[model samples]
Target: MTPTETTTDHPPRAGAKEWIALAVLSLPAMLVMMDLTVLHLAVPHLSAELAPTSSQLLWITDIYGFLIAGFLITMGSLGDRIGRRRLLLAGAAAFGVASVLAAYATSAEMLIAARALMGIAGATLMPSTLSLIRNMFHDDRQRTTAISLWMMSFMVGGSVGPLVGGALLEVFWWGSVFLVGVPVMLLLLVVGPLLLPEYRDPRSGRLDLASALLLLAAVLPVIYGIKKLASDGFGWLLIASVVIGAVFAVLFVRRQRSLDDPLIDMELFRNRAFGATLGIMTAATFAMMGLNLFVMQYLQLVHGLSPFRAGLWVLPMTGAMMVGMVLVPVLVTRIRPGYLIAAGMAVSAAGIAVITQVGGSGGFDLLITGTCIMAVGFTPAAALGTDLVISAAPPERAGAASAVSETSNEFGGALGLAILGSVGTAVYRAAMDTDLPTQLAPEAAGVARDTLAGAVAVAGELPAGAGATLIQLARAAFTDGLQATAAVSAIIALAGAVLAAVLLRRVRAGEDVEPNSDDTAAGQVTPNVVAT
Candidate 1:
């Protein structure tokens, strides 16, 4: 990694070539995320076809995220060592191959294995694309603008996944949803090398394999345990995952501190902007992911809508996210990013507060309006947080910073779904009597509580009078649970926003310099100052 290799420049500013590069790179990036949510929409269908037990269904859905969370930091470091562009090409090819495996998977076991492999490939795409963008756009306004587009693509992919999946299911088999990634990946495999500049750290050394393994040991079990608890409630495996997570967490931290070439710069935690920005990223994702589950459930179960219809109803949040992403960079020049973050979280809290008050019988208008407002609030928080994290770290370490930011995203979403989703399940189940009709099987009752869609399916199969009564009870109970969860999530979002505001105050005032200047070797410049 010579200086020439490390300093390969991109197109000037947000020119057509640069934006085209961003768009092309973001295509595969979007596909990876779309894979997550697209499968989510197909889960019921997948469950039926695969005949997976509830636990297996949970694994099929959650293992990708767990794998992604565990390996993000390690892969990010590897990209910086091996070259981000080369890794992106390799990852895209592997992702395409994994998609074929996922599409053709015969059993829940095979799908789970394929999904985990997909996670490995998907993990390589995120940090590399984000860090590449950071390297490509050096000017402040251009960089911020590129981040806005990048953020928009992420939110839009998440929002559109179910809609697209639902449409695909109507025309093709459930497996066709997995096939969506093939062409996009091939496009990346071709165009990415030409347009995307190659970069690697000259000073970076062999990846700390031991620390990487330690991180995997620490993070994966915890996420796996949470998924188990969400689906089946707590048990011995859950307990073991928690205990193992604690042990490996301590060990991983110690290893990182001692390593000559650490997987993550543990000391990045001391940077106020970087740390708080990570919190903003985490909290925003938590609220967004948690709300997505309840809102989809609310539309489908309480409102008696189909998956496609429910996706349509929640479309405004997706639209708002895109609109917000476009607006944030413009706002950053006028208002301090700290204020924008605080305001964004505050707005999201307001939306969540409105969602809490929603009744089982509320109209779609309320759902759409609430989610849109929340998205408007959340969009700025996400884009700005990414900006701050990239700005705060050295250029060579950009991949690692991006990885940490993404880890926060993956783990935060998993934690949100697990913890808050479990709360909803518990509340719903508790409200139902233990002595459900002798005719109603335990498995049937369990299905009703898993998701609103499942509840509606259960309702259709029951006797009319019994079905109506049980449906009303289930809907009310789930709404009650949502109210509780939304309130707590709103509080968390507000608290995170406040903390981000305070932490960013020093940096926002431009009263101090960023801590990591080693980026000088990687073409980074000081504020209003040149690199030495």
Candidate 2:
């Protein structure tokens, strides 16, 4: 190719208008993440008001995530067929309407339906925002920077979700948490059209309806099974759900290979950088989310802190993540992504090691320090791994690639929660089984052996000396569980670091792997590699 032809092939660097649009795009990204955790603190209030049964309450809490994970690929592919900006605006409007319905819902069933609608709407926002970034910031360096800022918004939203929810719940009713998204979605709908550019694959074929249904069938059951395993433990029903989901997934993949216009481009996974980055992202998220489950409970139950207070302690870690986000974009300009990602994982592993030293009491300082360190270490993987995934695909297929990236994260998080939670529960039960006071009745002993919360409740009915001994043993046993979970997390993070370093060593700074000949012929943009 001639120099001018090469120059013309790449889009120009993003200007100020693109940067402003990036700010607008971040609103929905933050809102979607916030929605994931915002309802945790509101569960008690909502249950009391709505008087939902146990199963209904679980549905009200979990249905949002289930639908989001299930619909991501479909919505992402749909964006490529339709216009990304068009889908985003429509989803935003839907999200706003759903939020209002949820906030004013009188019945648990209504709230569950509203949350489900919000989830489906929420799925469109993430991939659309990411794909838009891919198109808007064509310059490699600028795109990396934009992605860092975008990922930072998600971290901030996750960390603050509880804090925001707690604040709202303290003043308003449980429904107020749902209302928070209404204004944000309203703003997105009003301004999205004015600022964001709409882009879609001109050569893309019609979206197949069968593939869409197969995808939902495949994803929903698998995710539901994982969530159930985490909450209810091993069961024949959960195993069957997972098996059925796997069967549908196989059908979905086979159908994709036969279709002229597949919902997902299987070629994207054939790229080394794309596949490796996805694996590394999954591993990192697995460790982070698993350990996070214990840390939150540890702060509230062991440390005798309120929900709001626990959220406050989590802020330092979030602050560390924000600082890392700012730095990773600059560091990537000088260092290869492999080295940066590897180094970050190593640091996160060290943080997990520190957390293993935490005891049942007076562990506030240690837990905070360890989590902050972990956040700093993992930040590079969060920011750069996402950039690599999006960059691996041609711009036309960026939406599908973004959805794949998100699905890996969701799957990793669910897996982590299930496996690590099971391990911790097993350890806790073993310890409690031997330590329970012999004088306790069978019913009380069974309850105490089941969970830390149960032990605390059971202890209140005992005599002073017996209650004291039971409380002490229960806290110690829970601490043992926490230590074991952190140990597993440390090992996972360490392994991920090694994997990234080895697999991604050839990928240079500010550039993705070169597309193959087929990709080039199919109009993939060659990444501009920066000199080492």
Candidate 3:
């Protein structure tokens, strides 16, 4: 089929300018996703400057994602009603303003609020860039190539975020890192109007207020619960959060079924390609997020590296991702995507297996070797999974579908941290039992563990023998926990690869082709595939 024969939701004649618009819109995605990991590197500085309470520090890093998870569907659907280009610009402006709020904040609470607002704004950018790219690219080869680069920029941001944040922290304060997004947003805002075409769903209905509320009600508590699990462990609060999230989730699904224009088209799951691809993406994200969190902590605390040095050590992973992004587009022409994902997963499993052996005694060399191998092994799956999500959805529903993809990304990260983090904490506490100063009041250990500095301080006040024993226990416990987590993640990655091969076996090359929207102008119509 010709380019014009497959174009949908826009003029069939998109050129290089349209591609530029797609790339520029992706900038905000990079900024938003980058912020997710960048804050870990900045935590030490933020704590020193703001003296945020333990809960407040977690909020500072997590609120952006929390709000994004809560509002993604509503905002994505809204973009389909209003012009996507309009919403992208509006979201960019909001993001810029939020960045300003975050940068100038005098208190931790203020910064947390700003990040939440930025999440709401950031949600708008992700779906718009992806759906817009689907609108712009018609030829299968060109679309594959475009989606590859688009996925690259977003993943690259994630990989490079800690490095960039660390570099900025070396010279400037923690707040300065928030300002890094400003220039990129400006470039998007400036170029968006000149090159991007406007698009909206003419048939979109009124925003369903009840469904939106139910969505926020559902996602927020679950994410909160998971985050709590990471910090604490299994408890009443965690159980309640899970229960409440489930209740809201039930309501949200019911509302979607009854409503004329649902926030999510429930029927989209019937597409095998779309459904299985999302699963792969979600599972991949779970492994990546868990690894990133533990490795950074291990690098800084146990390895005795500065935040800047820790970030620099993550470069191999980032470099591997860029290489994978560049290579996958070319490889897709000859090999099936399912096989690509499987091969990648096998390699990733091997890499994570290596991490299982790392201990407190391991140096940066060990960290680099493990993270680099895992990154190379996993990059192909991440890049391919995203491409599949975009290619599987119809044009009109692309925004909603992309929102689902990002939600999986956000939720996977949140849950991975919660579950794996809890695992780590439990092991740490377990191994340190009596060595954990029962002598120094309960309040002291609680306060000390809350801050790295406080933890170090408490070590000083203890008796020499007790303090040395305590440090030894803490290190041993953490290493054991991390190794266990890595083993589980490797198993999960391997299982996911097997499942993907089974689910995607029928997806032949060029299955993404669709009848062009211009076919309507030419008085031809295509048959629709019914949901099974």
TM-score of each: 0.89, 0.95, 0.88
Q: lDDT score of model 2? A: 0.87
TM-score of candidate 3 against the unseen true structure:
0.88
Superpose all Cα atoms of candidate 3 onto the true structure and report the RMSD in Å to 1 decimal: 5.3
Best-fitting candidate, measured by lDDT? 2
- True-structure RMSD, every candidate: 4.3, 4.0, 5.3
**What is the C-alpha lDDT profile of model 3 across 73-157, one tens digit per residue?**
7787887777678888999999998998998889998998899889999889888887777666666667677777787787768
- Regions of candidate 3 where Cα sits further than 4 Å from its true position: 1-15, 40-58, 107-109, 434-457, 462-469, 512-532
How does candidate 1 score on lDDT? 0.79
**Per-residue CA lDDT of candidate 1, range 1-532, in tens?**
2233232244245567778899987897688779888997678777888899877887788778777888888889898888888888998999899999988889999998889889999999999999898777776768888888888778767778888898998888778899999999999988987788887776778998888888899998888887777767879999999899989989998988887778888887766667778887888888888777888878877887887888777677788888888888888887877888898999999988888888786655776787888889998778888888877777778888899988888877877888888877777667655433556788988777565557668878999998887677777777887777788789978987897677665455222234553112123342221111
Cα lDDT over the full model 3: 0.76
> Which regions of candidate 2 fall more than 4 Å away from where they truly are?
1-11, 514-532
Query: What does the lDDT read for residue 384 in candidate 1?
Result: 83
- Candidate 2 residue pairs in backbone clash: none
Poorest lDDT segment (10 consecutive residues) of candidate 3:
517-526
lDDT of each: 0.79, 0.87, 0.76
